[model samples]
Target: MAADLERQVAHWLAAARTFRDAEEFASLEAWRAVERDVGAPLRRQLNTVVEELIALGDATAKLIATARYDAAALSQAAAAVQRFRRRYFQVDVTLDFIGDAVNTRTSPVLRAALTTLDRLAVASMVSVLQKANKPVPRVLVYQDKGTGASILRAGVRLWAPGAVMPCAAIKIVRHNLYRPTSLFHETGHQVAHLTGWNPSVGAALAQALGHDEELRAMWTPWASEIAADVYAFLHSGYASVAALYDVVGDAETILHWPIGDPHPIGWLRTALGCAFARRCFSEEGPWVALQRSMETRFPISAADTTLQPLLVRSMAAMPRIAEACLSAGVPALNGRPMTDVLEPARVSPAALSELERTVGAALWTSPHWRETEGIRIVALAGLREAEHPETASVWINRARAWLTSEARAA
Candidate 1:
């Protein structure tokens, strides 16, 4: 039994050393070429967690080696090694996701387009943070199939204790890749986090609801998602709303709002988006058509008894919520209404049309135009596709050309 205990300790001692080798096994050099802003911060976070884990392995090896222990003591040492092993796997899973993000350049088709898309996010963030004079963190766009699009925002706690994410790792779906207003929506989440925009919008929505306790409670929690939606709207205008409507699917999806979900039900959500567009642009084409499509596809009169009233009341109050969201004072914007800063008018259909005409051939070809107007051009393409479904391929190819140019310049 004494010899068996010694052998067991030796086994774990080797296991612990093997754990330390995980840091080098991945050969993180592939990530070395990531933009310095992205690479530097990511390396710091990764190093902090990895070094601490490596140090633990060293300590664990020392503990098991230096002691001659009873069976109970040996069990404890083995358990310590097991715990370290578990923690290592957690970091490993995180690195896999990060690897997925940074290794996107592996494929030629995705490399340029996604790279330029990453730059678009960085540029948009810079525009947002300029007023506050905060440094813009880098963005990494990776492809994944999941609920619409999502972001793992910078500064959020990650797998390892005390490890904060260093950049916005945005997941972009393949179908929406060419017409990705949802990119703006995910980036909007990071913007809201950085600017502290969510709670402020929640408070304003709550106050605007006045005496309606249930409605106030319902909408207040939705502020983060709502703020992101409006942020997407500001940058992409009706394109965001149209993309949202398309993604929400048919009657069943539009009518269904899962409990405890932070998103407004599609019923209220579509209405709110269209309302915001009308508020900003003062008239609506695609927004109104989308609202009608959502409404008539699944009429509320036919909805379940419980869902109908929530829909009606929320719809009635949506314009007010929309008004408050865009109109309310925001300290983050130095008390300017969001419209003043984000300038929703810039992406409005009329403005986009004029931009399309003015930029003409340069819109697709000019590097200067790509840098300045790439985000808007994407919105224009998406909005046009929504309006004239026939033009989808033309616009997609054009956007792809623009993105390819951006990558070549880089």
Candidate 2:
């Protein structure tokens, strides 16, 4: 089932990249024309798969919601809910350029594209979960400002009505004036929570580090974000990485840290993402081999190597941190083992190779590459190397060249 979900995710990512690349040289009309040429067959396939999954997800959710509770039943149902949430409620994303400037308010085409993308993302997520034999969630995607906050509010409201556990809602905000990848990164957080991959390590780490502001700030820090990146890497592969880069890296600036939040620094996030991917695929998989090739092609800096120590330290302290949080009465930090939710699955070398190839191709062809921020490129380069060291050196060289050229132009 896990293999199936991974493969399906790979397929959707490939198709998405192809569409994105095709659109680069084509206008809106041209892209639409191509979709017309191909959309029918694709849509038919997509619709059929999606509808069946939706029904399955709905049924599963109902059974769990109403079932009599025994310890075994409760455990099964909890696990089922976790799986269903991932299958039914994961977000599918597409980015459209509104104009020379990203003007969400004024861009009719962008708005329309966002709406279509949201619907497709929802459908695809639902179908993939069902394919994996998991139940689905009731999902809603918001396109306006404050989508995340609003969705949380709606979830609270639904809880009031005693609707099946408050459904997960995601907001797919446009990257009009800011980096779109940041939004995706946040979405990754939402996905991690729903999918049950987010490590229950933050609170543990915070407690271990002591309860100062720094520790409090670190409480729900990059562990969740990093987990999401790893999930995105495994689930969506390179296109997911590319999408992240596109949204976070700006063509005009060296780096534009997100304006308002205290999220971990972006470059670090990217680096950790790549590292996690490498660790996941380093074994005997073709995907691992390909990732090895990519990594070797793209080497990162020595200074950045420091992240490994931090990650290790955090990982080691996680259980202790969770224990501390539990003792301290922080409900959010109470431990819930992710392994209970996500069944273990292996990615064959072939699968790893396929993912690397697809992601490499996507990175080369992504429209946002030229415009992406330098730090992000560097971080991704590191991640790619960590995942596929064979390819890292070459990829990093290419990245460095791009960075140099951009710097020279600036």
Show where candidate 1 strays beyond 4 Å: 1-33, 69-76, 406-410
Q: Weakest 10 consecutive residues, lDDT, candidate 1? A: 19-28
Scored by CA lDDT, what does every candidate get? 0.77, 0.39
Measured on C-alpha atoms, candidate 1 has an lDDT of 0.77
Reference-based TM-score, model 1: 0.90
Q: What is the TM-score of each candidate against the true structure?
A: 0.90, 0.35
lDDT of 1 at 77: 64
lDDT of 1 by residue, 92-176 (tens): 6666677667765655556777877888888777777888666687898877776489999988888877778988899888788
TM-score of candidate 2 to 2 decimals: 0.35
Clashing pairs in 1: none
Error of 2 at 225 (Å): 3.5
Best by lDDT: 1
